[model samples]
Target: RRPRRSAGPVSEAESGGSQGVGAPLGVMSALEKQLHLGRLPPRPPLPGGGGQSGSKMRMGPGRKRDFSPVLWSQYFESMEDVVVENETGKDTFRIYKSGLEGPVLLLLHGGGHSALSWAVFTSAIINRIQCRIVALDLRGHGETKVRNPEDLSAETMAKDVGNVVEALYGDLPPPIMLIGHSMGGAIAVHTAVANLVPSLLGLCMIDVVEGTAMDALNSMQNFLRSRPKTFKSLENAIEWSVKSGQIRNLESARVSMVGQVKQCEGAASPECPKAIVEGIIEEEEEDEEDEEGGGSVNKRKKEDDTETKKEHLYTWRIELAKTEKYWDGWFRGLSNLFLSCPTPKLLLLAGVDRLDKDLTIGQMQGKFQMQVLPQCGHAVHEDAPDKVAEAVATFLIRHRFTEPIGGFQCVFPAC
Candidate 1:
């Protein structure tokens, strides 16, 4: 059986054996080393060209591959790759740091998206704010693949998130800020209510709320079902993604598709045209109802002459079955968290109000902060990253994570 969640956060000193990406240094425990000194590698400086400036680096080759230029930059190289494990399984998180002496921001992406979704905004945060950012690719999403998933419970996912927090920040770390989008927002609240991260200063939910419309959920499920099982090429996948309204921005969509897709193991199979038959056989006998001008039975039988379809080795990296297992619980968990979570919180919603009709923000206004961005879609950060980042920075300041940074500027050229 899984362990019971504490009413409050547990310290690293109490939980003695949390396995992580790598073992601690000699004579000192991992938590002790991190607390007393800076243990991680030094972060590389942010690249030049703050806002929409021409590229300084040269393009040497004749034909450049279709990749997000922002994702290919030097900024990504500075992020520390980390893996943490508990009884359940191991998962990876990318840590972006400004310094060791600052607050930490834990970012969780929505379903069907990886930790890389935060790469653009994380860069923005590190460039302007003095804070460490960590983005987790939740179980069955991104690089954290699950085989034969046993537990898809919100409690299970929250517990894993807690373990990760303990592994990275230890018993006591700097003030923490939790940021999550869509389905991730629900998980964020579950983690907070569980009292997983002791130093958690505030929680921010983007484009998600406890009572998201049932129609919205059904629409998402339908869209997922409509997607092709596999794509022959990256470009083809992007085209489908755009047509399906999964991603709006072309550049970002390309990056997302590339990260989510893997090469096929076997040779590509040739497509065969389906044959159509034209002959029709008339039945000699007719129904008695047909004689009385009623409906008659058509005896023309249609046969599927097509050959059995071959399974493509190439497919999306997402663990669809595992994620689907938690569908009902994801919504239910939110209602529970909204009622019980004691942490200070901020809720950021896009332009649409379908998810907020029952939210009744006015009632909870005193208990938490709420903001709505005009002209923004479900993926608020990706749709209006600058606005989202600035709002987050302001929220952090309000929570005392960092002092106000005047005239906040966009960190990346794309933004």
Candidate 2:
């Protein structure tokens, strides 16, 4: 069904929240049937080399598709290294910023994804409305360096969000909207609950509903295992990410893939970016975090991933499998937290079925705006950035969070 268009909250019928709750397929519920958790990417074709034994990966658009990684500067105005001092120590968190004025859209990417993941969404949103973007590479993911990267507990990350905001603006900050996707969405809710961002005017969560997320957790490991372990080159990673449906948008994948992988130790290709290829030691030490979480240490797998990494030119920046222990924590009580947020709210999902009981009830009572964008994957912002941007821009404009830039208009009714 097409996404419902309105100036108000989504109706129950349109939300599809009335679907049967039981598992028609024994263990898989009707809701989980639509969930695409960690999509297992097929092995990418290595130039003349084959991908898998039965290679069927489709080629990208154009006669000659370029899979090269794009620089962050192509999308963001500037990148900052905010040094946040706390009881633990001084931690440097990397943030990418854009736009000159108006309210700030503080973006938090999902677990295992980087701030760069928001590159496409940032451009689309800015064009539709007057706003700024501050996309942070969370503690464990991307370029954010923290003393304790393994502490993905809700409390720690919520505190990190507060610390970064405080570090950026001492006491008074601009009117800010906490917009997050997947794990980031949960963090945004927790941040709101903690009253971390005093200037927070709105909250938007993309494609992360507690009910579906919890059910999908049981199959997360299978999804992780099915992914391609390594790429022969940087371009290989981007191509695989797109063709494998990991990220549907090509332009988004080009810029975002670089943040998800790093040059493989002892196997750096000539095409590997200089910055990534040179930080072998720092990255390796970062890997030590897996042990602390007990997710890859005495309590977790002992597989020889080191051998496999050596066989490739590039490998995943974070082995998400090790961080499995924190999965429940990321989403537990997320619904209540999101609903409890007093700020104006928006929930953007890839499918109407994603709406859980709590959120559906809240929407009926007009607690927040819910937009269902079907046909896209879980990475809703990346898959359909224009639609996501339009939905968000309209929500902001309706509430007068910020004035529209030239050539933009608000047609949707105010909530």
Candidate 3:
């Protein structure tokens, strides 16, 4: 995302999709509709004041939004680094947890996203239920340091997850539920099938289905290349992510975005990420503020010099395009694996259309539970974390996996 002179207020869809918005801004961006990053429109350049003195154009009247990356502790109780040993060496995985003693809900994030993606949901669920949350930054993503980062095969990642759980709790651990989004969903399926989590209690996948995932592969490369390789500042990155519909909830974007990017080797922003407390984080519904940013974005980019464009821009931590080698391995026969797993299963999707023939049949046969939440994009958990928490809490409680805490009540078909 670029930092340029802002135009006056522009309109963005309320939900960043074809919902609750006027026609002109209602069309969903290509990226907002596709795979995990789902289809969304091309991103517009963002405007900011302070530190961006290098740009030639003057700032516009549009209000500058706070895009600071929030710290993990704001949402989780603790951040632990678990080291798992392998033939190559020891790999350290990042785990963010809350709720000291209860059934564990191990959260695995999607490709390109990190454990922090579960920030909002973690806070919401723990308040509603008596459950422990253990969110992992899978290999090659987030703060995880692995022997071979690029080894993203399902088998390797599944083993990596199993090893981490074993390292954290040992052979006889408490009952655990595996919750994953997109790529992480596939890993959860594989982990269960491999008997990796012997203490496994239940499985929940958010916004990912085998049929939709397989169809999305053909356009995955194009979608990856469409993303901005660098951002002028952390705020710029966060703003772009919101406006571009990467993370619909501003609060979620603030905490989750920190793990999605890293400072460029030779260029770092003056206003880098800062750790702030949870009480300070508040959600702002500013979706309609960027509809008219097109002209200003074009003008600023045209006037900005090469010096401003290349220096001090942050890049994505991982390039999803390169991981293309293992994409098929992540989703092929995924439905079968998920169905075969003996654990209780829950598949959460953004759209019911994501269901394939097999999964649809399985649902009809009552093999697992299915719930579809509308008005959200591919990152269902991030876009609508409270609803996700409700759905999950209901599932866990209904199955007697864990009890609700804090006087929280359960609401089925939540959202």
Candidate 4:
């Protein structure tokens, strides 16, 4: 008979002893030493140019480059931009292009993020699929300018996407596959449900839930409420970010994304503008206080609560509020819309760092196949670029409308 084991808890020392002597010390010693102290040679500063090399540098990591023609040559060949007007007359859609011939992929970014977020993925897709990729900077974000306040709504944003698509590739068959993150994902769903574009091969939603403006507002309220106290200066903010491990392991491109959020001059300076920083601090405090105190208020009231509202309106907050209205309508009509469309869809659900799991579950039940990326956070593409790339490639290959001449018919071609 097997010896009866005591149902007792194990202590750390006992556990360590069981692993053999000196294991803890060896582990500690190894961790104490830096692994890459002098392993990597310094990279040379990139050369200046307006074409592909510059664009490649701008695009940053996890992006593919063809070396046959050289990095610079390929980069130059892939760089182009066009300005398309939003149908709602609220924004100018700045469309950046990569890849020459192939199917079209429209990449839309999430709230507080720009099309530049897709730069790495765009580069990879362009090289791998021989497909044209267009990344659009939505209104009030990145280089895109919002022309009208009304155009900020979700429906209008979806309309803007349709307009830009028609304007750029109307002549061509709808060689478009929609990939959207966060807010962009919502817009993509809206566009699909509305049947704004013909022949949408697939829709990929990255980390967004189906909902209305109220949901967005609630999300923002929760986010603001959970934030640490605002800093007195910009340097302090950066320092805090660095110390908190937020910016420590981030790539240069990711750092650049944060840099774009710096609004005031001398933000990098030690003597940063107190007024600007204070305004941010005050707004966050007010938001937290209001939400906690059960004060039901709209954007105008929230703005009025801040002393520097006229001078330093948080563009992010305003944009969020505008999006909330659209989300409200979307949430109400989501079921009917999903039933009506039933288009093949890919939903990349992050396994970590998300507040709502039900949203993802609901999507899965609504005929959206979910790929739960283990150990990934809200920014699935950024956190796991290789995995994302693989998934994207597989998706494209599976649903590819255009067949390659004299090429493999299936991913798993029969022997």
Candidate 5:
């Protein structure tokens, strides 16, 4: 099915109401004004990484560790940091890789999200199944700062995935399995069709359908547009996300925010003296720097100096407006195109109503293997992680992508 093109553009209300039933009236008036008018109010200056800074300071470890209570406690211990460069642009993006080795599972997150979106289930899958899991921060999102807005297109994103594949798995890599969520799913389809990953053995789409309704697209855009561009604290961001239905739970919301929000070096949350403490600690560390002499320590000192020079703000990591440009075109005729891909495909539908109404077995028959995860939402893995992992492990085993691990234990103790 192909998306129906609109002859004329629609207004904000027509696009979809920005205020949810629970949202206060006029809550988005300021954002709407900014949207219609020119440039948004100048965001406070923050330290600029510009994809070049690889300092551990670029991602505040103490700040990230602070959120462990609400999020996964052992997250930092599980994944290894990775950076991949697009051969064409030579642009490098950050990714977190689960070290388990077998076939490679490359993950692409939805628009406005980064590799951290997969955090909830990444380790679970790795522990349950024998395969390496690589999740990347897409262009214009997270640590990836894109030079060209044009590169955000589906076609370009597909090429970026290709570049990552080449960088991670050489000219002729091992069998590759792609699992993408929402916008990532669209990119995965395009990448598969583009023949970017010759070793691509399978594809999985999470919560996306070809010819996705325009209303759905509009609703998503409206929600993103209406959101406050900055939050005073990560907790504030988490509250907003939970209220807005972007995520269903506070724990997932906090972990997901690690990727979605960036703390400008100067902007400190009013609730805590955490930033003040960090500043004091940095000053003390600088005084003690001579004790540890090495090229690495010298490099760290340079990075610290760079970090100290710029003011930082708390703002979104994603370039929201630029990423929105591809929404309408992304879904058009994608379902059929991906269904026809030579590699086997799996469709994981999350919303119960959608599974009941749109994903009848007869319709799906011979098209691709489809599975429904009960109580899941658009953020399928976060909402129902254990279920998603179980389903994925089964799919991989069925495809012979990996061998079955007997007496598979649940990653989450509650599960």
Candidate 6:
């Protein structure tokens, strides 16, 4: 039987405390500090120039420039890398497209994550399957640029997704497979319900419950209200990651990823001007200050900023605390929204973890089918990449879409 649903809303602090139980926050904080500091690699001198003395030297046209395709080969294989400028002019997206012969698959990443999250899986799937794949970094994340926080709303986000889709296919095919994780999943649902993308093939949501964003925002606001202090240095942030075991066995990857997102040179120095990271931290600080007795207008603006920032942290520990409660309303809304779509859908649930089963089952009723992946957790792709690929392959094949060369065999044997 499913556990009884809590009668009232749970504060983000309480939720975080529940998850952080037996976990040492102090040690983790220290480790995170170190990870943050370790991001910078040894810098190489620029070609045709010496250090400092040749800092102003510029290479003339027709000179052979460094085009190290190796660095981006993984993400561009079997796909065309293109940039689409949105009508708003302030926003643009780096998109990767694969396949021309088969149906289209719109791949979306979770919040705070970029399109790179789908690199490993998409590469494998594209090789075997004959379907087109369009992976996009949602606005305010990865390569996509957003000028205003108001653009982070569900409607706006869905429009961004729609814009990317329209740019690529141009109304060529109906029933496009829409797959998203975390915040991306919410945006996918919103787009499908809004009829932004027509002839939806199927929807696959990874580890995100419906309406999880608002709950997460409220929780984060409360959590920040409890404590608001900047880290002394980047090393402190790395140390926090280490002690928290957020990266676990993949310390280097974790370090690299965090470095990609948040890092600035020299200890105790000013933070860098990366818009997304700055926006997130600034919003959090504003929320903290507002809760300490700001005026109504200031509080409302801070609240709006908090919601925008929450979307960027959707896939990480910063947002997980609120997902547990947020999913209830989220899934309920999705249950109603998805009913309008004619395509058969699939819900990949992590079987091993203790999730809200009633919520899961309730949301899938009539509108979609569910598949419980045993021994998997929230990051289903990372935990069981092969199984996820196989499930996706099979779903496409069953729907009369082109199947990959090897058929729908389980790639991850353990899964």
Please report the candidate that would top TM-score against the real structure: 3
Candidate 2 lDDT over 1-415, as tens digits, reads 2232333444555545543432222233435544422233444566657653223344443234567899999889999999999775789999999999889999999987899999999988888788999999988888888888888887889889999999998899989999999999999998999999999999999999999999999999999977776665678788788767888888999999989988765645433332322111112223465545545442222242333344356777878888888889989888988989899999998988888999889988999898888889988899998888889999998898887776887667354
TM-score of each: 0.65, 0.75, 0.77, 0.59, 0.66, 0.57
- What C-alpha lDDT values do all the predictions have? 0.61, 0.80, 0.80, 0.54, 0.67, 0.54
Question: Once model 6 is optimally superposed onto the true structure by TM-score, how far is the C-alpha of residue 248 displaced, in angstroms?
Answer: 7.1
Candidate 5 residue lDDT tens string, 15-42: 4655443222234355544453343354
Tens digits of lDDT, candidate 6, 256-318: 233224323433333322223211122234445667765664556456545543222212223
Cα lDDT over the full model 5: 0.67
TM-score of 1: 0.65
| Local distance difference test, candidate 4 | 0.54
Over the stretch 1-415, how does candidate 1's per-residue lDDT look in tens digits?
2333323444556445453423233334557556534644554444543321222122453433343323524334355646776575665654443434467788888877767667667656665566777777777666664443345567877876787788776887668888899878888888888788888888888887766634466566676765566654556566555445565555566655655655455444322112222221211223243566644444222321122122333356664544665777877647546645677777788744644443565335466667778776577776666677778877776666685444564322111
Candidate 5, TM-score vs. the true structure? 0.66
Off by over 4 Å in 2: 1-62, 267-312, 413-415
Q: Candidates 2 and 4: which is better by lDDT?
A: 2
Q: What is the alpha-carbon lDDT of model 6 when measured against the actual structure?
A: 0.54
Off by over 4 Å in 4: 1-81, 85-91, 211-219, 225-249, 252-262, 265-273, 276-324, 330-339, 352-366, 402-415
lDDT of 2: 0.80
Tell me the lDDT of model 1 at 119. Answer: 64
Tell me the alpha-carbon RMSD of every candidate: 26.1, 17.0, 13.3, 15.3, 19.9, 20.0
Clashing pairs in 4: 52-75, 52-76, 90-147, 90-148, 212-327, 212-328, 213-324, 213-327, 213-328
